[model samples]
Target: MGSPRAASSRSRAITEVCEAKLRMMGGSLRELESGKAAALEEEILRTDAKLEELGQLADAAARDLREDFEQAMELLQSTRRVKEHMLVDHRQQLGDVAERIAALRSVRDEGVKACEAADHAEMVSFLSKHASTYSQECWQLLARPLPRSIQVPLDDIPFEVAKRRDLLRGAQCSEKLARMKNEVLCDIVDALRQERSTHADTREYAVEVESLLEAYATEWEKRFDYACSYCGQVLEAALANEPYCGAMPGRKAHHWVPTDTAGIAEAKETARPQLPVAAASPRLKSQAKIRAISPMFRADSSV
Candidate 1:
């Protein structure tokens, strides 16, 4: 009975030891699982951080690309506008030149006709006889040698009357030629003045458009940090002193200047006077004088 009881106690002790070992093994397994969970959590956090960093980098890259693309587009648009203005200006110049050429041809034709009329033999012979007679009279008055004058009645003069008629015709033709020449000269001058004015207007408009485009580009560039993507330099430094560039200096906010359009219009209205219809030439001359003096008074009063 004592041996059996000792054997039973030994078996119980072995069971207790086995149970303790199992508990220890279970605790170690729990510790390993906890460590694995912590490691996985840390890995997840690291992956999230890496992804956030990548996202930030991607956003920055996208912003830079967008900025660059916008700048390129603005430059292209500016170039296109300038080209269009130039093409229009060139076309206008060509048209003006063609019109001037036509005007010159017309003037040349008029001159050729006048010259042909002046070269008529009958007219020339009549003018020559009058010239001889006038020269003789002039020489006699100046106490110089005079040719012998044929004394004949006016109606009985055969070639003398014809000579006088030819002289009158030559004088009339000369006056007509002079008037035509003056008209041609005036037309040419007017055409030149118009061409010059048009050219000036075109240049002014082109400059204004270019300035507007540059101002827009400048404002857009300032929003993108004004940095050159290619050279990594500050774009402001590159464009500080440049008159025209893809990126320009930003304009400071300014107060709007007041316009005097209404005042000018009012002043013009007040100064402008109604004129009476000129029935006589004297009244017309008086009106002209009044008009000329009115401008001076208007200028002084406005000032």
Candidate 2:
């Protein structure tokens, strides 16, 4: 295992980038908060002013109305009606604010819980305590969730099997997993198909969910069908989108995994193959032409 100090010192590049992203988001959020506060303040001021004006109007009318029964009764009834209307409006406004507060609290609680656990809680403990029940049930439905990429499932050799030295170690675990994944994928397809066929009879909301699952499963099949060129292995439908594996140790998984054409082109350019040079000496391919000895020094004079 690596030391904590080593791990902490490994890299700050990712953290620095994350900090920069958060700073940018914080700026926008602050601006939004300021705008919302300003708007709310203006609304409160308007409401206060309206209430004061209503009170002033009532006082001015009541100052001379007590001596007149008809005017007094009319003023009293009108004032009560206006007060009732204002009360109802304020109640509705309060209800809306309460609802918005509740929603915000729920969002903040859920988001924070997912991102940051209790100071003393370990990740495993937090997950065990607060993991989604729906997601847990879905995961439990599978025998074992397959890795996105190929893997050696049988890493621990059985003692009985190991007794025979002739037997191959880790005997094609990837291939076995591939077949198992295909079987599971077929089952998923069947289930999704059944859901779709009867979805029209189900509740409208349920039909949307069913259709989404059907689409998700159909997309998964495409990835599941694609094979790794190096190992000819396929991933389980649940994790079929990943395209890498540790087929050989000390080798990059993507080296054997076929990926995007652009990435392939880039790789080709980066590691271009060189042409072989001739084994003969460079002098043999020299551009200069060799000349014969001058005829002036020939043993027999020119006839």
Local distance difference test, candidate 2: 0.54
lDDT of 2 by residue, 134-207 (tens): 34544453444332332333333234323443344434666788899999999999999999876743565444
Model 1 lDDT per residue over 189-274, tens place: 99999999999877765555454445534532332343343333454564546443333345332222213445445545655433
How many angstroms is residue 126 displaced in model 2 relative to the true structure, after the best TM-score fit? 99
For model 1, what is the C-alpha lDDT against the true structure? 0.60
Q: State in Å the error of residue 23, model 2.
A: 1.3
lDDT against the true structure, each candidate = 0.60, 0.54
Clash number for candidate 2: 0
Give the poorly placed runs of model 1, Cα more than 4 Å off: 1-29, 92-303
Clashes counted in candidate 1 amount to 0
Instruction: Give the Å error, residue 188, model 1.
Output: 80
TM-score, each model? 0.23, 0.18
